[model samples]
Target: MQATLMIYDGTAAPDSEIPRTGGVPLAPEGFIWPLCGDCCGGPMQFFAHLPVEYGVLSVFLCQNNPGSCESWDATAGANRVFLFPPAGLVAVAVPESGVTLLPAVSAIKTQVVTLEPETGDDDELPPDAYDLARSGWEREPGEWFGKQREVLGSLGGSPSYLEDDRLPGCPSCSGTTEFAAHLEEGIDRQTAMNLGGQLGYVFVCRPCSEGAFLTD
Candidate 1:
């Protein structure tokens, strides 16, 4: 299988139009920063700004009182994902209170890697291709361990290890949402968006211009 990995490039301007994590989000005029509805009832932390085939996927998760909120649940109000149009986007105004942004703006670049299918007994569960590709990212021989820090996540691939029942339906049309991207905390924990050390999943409904966020 072929997987497109999102490799960490370096620091970037917070409002730059690019694939990145932990930057201020770019949105259309009159956009309101989302508030966490599950717990703490504060502004959600901006997690990523990804440009996709249909539009830009802007993700957010609750950081204040993290464990108390269900940010990992797609239907929960603690986390949010938005599919915004490609043009006429400007940096959103930051909220004065609550955890609303990450400490760093990390940029991303893509690398396509070919994965070999796992050869296992028929009774065994199939391996997650995206996980295999991510665990296998290496800058050089014997550097796999260290190089993994540069892997932010991936785009346009099936949700890794995600169950069929967990797939989110479009909130508007009740149609199945397509897997959009995978999100990692980041290279530095201090600047990373907390996911309870788990992987994050993004889903979208292009026709409805809506999206969902969850973690596992």
Candidate 2:
């Protein structure tokens, strides 16, 4: 059967400056296949590993939000799964707090484990590191999702929300919040899991900010 062959050259890194030629080989059936899509039919990029740090994290702007885009905040609502190069599908359910670390290959080389699921022996994951999500639909409904366009609209896209001295303008009132506090309490690291773990983003207004430890 005379059929055009499709192939993906993973080794051959294509240059961004280089343009594709129409004469290039086209495979009738591509080497790779579609993975997942949003409800609005927008493509979703399933990543291979989770980001250890928050800044370099991968974000999926959901093209399926009704009348708006649903940008799943990785730390807030993303369903993280380790993608295998060979396996067609595998899942690693994560905590609602997001992934802490990509576990090194060990007993979980092939199978994906659900979050905090009691395996009786508890050999699935270590006591300290983070776990991933098995599926997007399996995420907790507590993710406070709002109108994507409206959320960005309130922020003015400052491009420096996380930067030092800059604050992520609140979407509720579109008000600029001051740097509140870093929690000097000695129990911060001691009871990390108790007080919502660690204090990450704690913004407050004039009254709220002053109400905190003003001695500093």
Winning candidate number (lDDT): 1
Question: Cα RMSD (Å) per model?
Answer: 1.7, 23.0
TM-score per candidate: 0.93, 0.18
- lDDT of each residue in 136-215, candidate 2, tens digit only: 11245675432111110010111212454344343234466443322111112321111122222233333221111111
C-alpha local distance difference test of each model: 0.88, 0.22
Residues 1-216, candidate 1, lDDT per residue (tens digit)? Answer: 888899989889999998999889999999999998786789999999999877999999898887888999988789888899999999999999998989999999999989888798999888777888888788465664647878889998799988899999986788989999998989887657788898999999888877888888
Q: List, in order, the clash count of every candidate structure.
A: 0, 10
lDDT of residue 184 for candidate 1: 90
The candidate 1 region of ten consecutive residues with least summed lDDT is 139-148
**Mind sharing the TM-score for model 2?**
0.18
